[model samples]
Target: MAEEPRDYEALMALYQAEKRRREAAEQNALEEKRGREAAEQKLRPTNLPEFLDACHIHLHASLIVQKNPTMSTQGNPDNAKNKLRPERLERWEDFAKHQMAIWDDIMASDFASKRQFAPLSALEQSGKDLRQQKIGSEIDLHIFQRDTVDKRVSSIIESMYYNKELREKFNLLGTVNFENHANMLSPESQLEEGMEQLTVHQKGKQAKEKQPSGSTDTAGSSHPRADQFCHRTAAFIVEYKAPHKLQLTHINNGLDEIELEDIVQDVVQRKVDDKDDVRRLVAAVITQAFSYMVNLGVEHGCVCTGEAYIFLRVGEDPRTVYYYLSVPEGDVTDTTGWTAGLEGPNRLHLTAVGQMPARPSTPSCGQAEKRHQSSDEESGPDPDTPSRQQSLSQPLSRTQKTTRGSSSGRGHHGERYHQIDRPTFLALMRRQLADDLDTDCDPVGRPGAIGVLFRVRLRSHGYVVAAKGTPAWFIQRLRWEASIYERLRPIQGIYVPVHLGNIDLETRYHYEGICELVHMMFLSFGGNLIGQHLTAENKTLVSEQVKRSADAIHGLRVLHKDLMPRNILWNEETKHVMVIDFERAEVEPISAKRTWKTPTGNSVKQGQTGPSACTKEIRRAMTELNALTIVIRL
Candidate 1:
């Protein structure tokens, strides 16, 4: 065949080997180019000269050195290398030097010129020369230097010279001009101008002095008179008179002796209206006298005028006029109702006798004794009694019977009269004991109780002790009171101690007996010592504590309807307080679904019940409690 096909397989192998060699060379060239680019991108210079050198090197490297095709395609050793001329290198060195020189000139031009301070320095030197020669003898050297620097120097130099006395003096020497002797004002002319100003000032002052005064003495002869008097009946003596004629007169031997007069003369002499002047004079006199009395260790028992009275006694004292004077009959009745059973007019009588001590005697005691002794005398039944009993014993009407039956159907029927005597009684007693233990003990005494006493019995020993029978209502009240303390126990450091014994219902009425006992205890202690009476500052503290307590009770709508002083306990050591007495607490839900009776007997729902309702209720309770405390004079 056609020369054995010329060994086609071997020829193909040779062609493939050549192709592989060419592809490897192209890849190598591309890798070399990429390496150069990466090196240039990452280059960094540490100094200015180094950075400039790097920039020159990069610029030259970026320039393309074109290949010479006229030489040989394979290799041309002689034409491969072409270098820059020696003159061009020399020219680049000169360009760099010129650039450096230009930079130096720019830096030099940035600095301010020295001519700005040249004139100032000349003036300062001339001033120094004049001062040395004593040419301007009247000029103050210290003042001139200070004014020249402070007023004339640039702010930059002033700040730099601050707090440096020598530097400031040097700056002044540089800034002030005192060498222009011909331009200075004459000392005689300056003195003449100053004299003219002084003369004008003096004339104005004289004119002002000659002007008539507008003041006049409106109080022609009024003078202040102040006096203090004490009454055995605790009455306040309010004296009203023209200040000039007012005097303190002592009634000894039925004759007046002037003890003090014109005590407040200066105050009364002030040009004021008669009412206002009198008030001021009286206030001054009272304040002064009060201070004097305090200094002398004399306590004021009462303060009173014809229309008002204030008592400062430790306890309820009938002899104190503040207790009785000008009080409305109804108010008095309401205030003193709690004491009715103990010392009311029905129980005790007082007759006025000449200078003799008025002794209290119970009018009902004799009548009670007579009734006790005559119990056996009434034994016979009369025919008139039988006839009267027949009418009284008539059968109840159908409607009345139905009403009575319906009332008994409810759980409250006869509940008040139910006796609490059983195993449950012991449980209740234990609960009461636990409550007493939980309460904080009062140092002075229990605030709202007649007395707190109990009896303890040991198993092996005889009865240890016993106390007087406490009223049933009082004990029930103590139970309610204990619940309040429990609710308030979470308040930090609030301590309210419930300390009392078991109540004896056999010998006590429910309501009146307990109320009287509480009233008596309060009276005995001068006031409720368990935070029933609080000052303005203490009231604020209590109000804040109550707010916190209310917040802690429920998220919002729960309110403590009764926020009285007796219900608030303060712990001084802990600086904390708590609210007690939740007997009147009611939950005001988000919806107005509850009804309450108004004082007028109309039913009304809690309006707009929400968190706001709770806050409002608390505020209202606080206000009502405050008003009640004030009315009771606690």
Candidate 2:
């Protein structure tokens, strides 16, 4: 019964070939790792900190600020007085402190203090040239109005952007737009009192204008309207006023001398002297900045007079505007460790301005976050009775939906999100997922470190698309989840949400205290929680649907590892159950059946099990689902 010598030699040869193949595979994997690391290194921007420092330095050097000589107020004097007043003015106590903390962190980091890149010398020289051009008497003649101030600031901002290294470092997805084209801020919105006049003028012009012969109404046209509202991706809002109109002295005297509460009342009652007049002027501009901030839903903005920059932030309340004045000429000193010795006015500090642009890159960082709704209240809204607003209000948090406080108890559940049709969603994905989409509302489900689930609407077609994303660190896990969805494509839009393609976001989402996720996976809204519509009448129906969904997944050899009632959704209209959250789910591996020799020298095949592991997991989930149903019924 001994094997032949030639057979043994053949087996040895096969073993050697297998070993060689393993070595080659290992070598290829090593090469791939090296390639990835090299690519990452190349993509990583160099001398960004140096460039930011250079921008601040050059901006201060080339700065030309002239005061307006005219001493007059526009519109009604009463209106001017009213414009300066807020419903309530509360001092943002921690505005400067928090900005300084970020600055300190930047300074303490290794990259901030590193040696300058080679191109930075050329960049600084260009800045010096700009400073030289502004040295003449022509600078004296130039009135530092909104346009002038914008040009001066934009010179530096543009310079920072043009540099390939700095753009990469900041991850500059959105532009620093001087022009405010937001539909909410448009004249028709009437965000400001005087805007009604502008709206009337526009309407009158529209009436006078004739349409082309045989042309239908733009709104009624089958084609997309040319005048459709387009959201300009603004990194942050910058409100500029002439330096002479709103001076550094005005801000210092108005804000420092008077309490915010008193300032509001003083402006309203038309109380007091020259100093109060200056305060009223400062307040008017601050009020303007607040309006723009609320309309845009951006938490941070700056009111930049040619001379000084008033870094502003809004907290949980839309009306409450926080201000921190930064005077580049005085506050920033050209010393070896000036940042270390700075007392206040951290806004224009090199580190602070440097860090500011990166805020939009990480949209959630350093902003207040709304509380996640508990599982009991995660059912969302009933489709039959959709009590929702026509337009979105500015949320307190960067990514949270608006909350209305009413005794009707609807405020506690948060705003209901509008849904997009499947055809529109597919068209958007086909075009470009990242470029076409913009964050519409707050996050949908509970956000974990691995990923954050939120709703993003299409830019041209305004309809919400559910996006699941994670930071680069957790991208693999997100990819894994996406792969699982791909495997379950057969049941998509039936027992699960439709799987839209995945994409890398054009811009990075920076959530303060949370991950800055760049990778996004798009999916259809998977309906609401199972318990939301689970009742005595539909309990059997719900249970059958849930069981059917579980079976469908199991049939695909996919095990729903973390299957629970929270992960299951029941669509009331469709009366179908959809399962979600497959982060921990696994596709069962396929293997050949094993044959073993018995002690009696008889060949026998391995016995089959009562049920497969995938089936077992489904059964276990069903048991938990049944228990949850019982609890809900009670």
Which candidate comes out best when scored by TM-score? 2
lDDT of 1 by residue, 1-634 (tens): 7755677767877888888888888889888888876554344212212222222222111212112323212211111011111100001123223333433432233221221222323333434543432111112211332232222222223222332442332232221111111101111222232332322112221221121233211221111111222111111122212111221111111111111123235345754555444333333323332322222223332222211222221112221111111111112221222231243221001000000011011001000001111111111111101011111222211121222222223222232232222233334444443345222211111111223322222112111221222232334434443344344434312232211223333222111101112210100001112233345445666666656656765443345654434345443433444444343455444456766422223455776555666667567646644553344343
Off by over 4 Å in 1: 1-543, 553-558, 589-604, 620-634
lDDT of 2 by residue, 295-333 (tens): 445677766654576677777866567666666556556
lDDT of candidate model 2 versus the reference: 0.49
Top candidate on lDDT is 2
**RMSD of each candidate relative to the true structure:** 46.9, 27.4
lDDT of each: 0.28, 0.49
Error of 1 at 524 (Å): 20
Assess the local accuracy of residue 571 in candidate 2 as a C-alpha lDDT between 0 and 100: 52
What's model 1's lDDT at 10?
A: 72
Candidate 1 weakest lDDT stretch, 10 residues: 347-356
Candidates' TM-scores? 0.23, 0.36
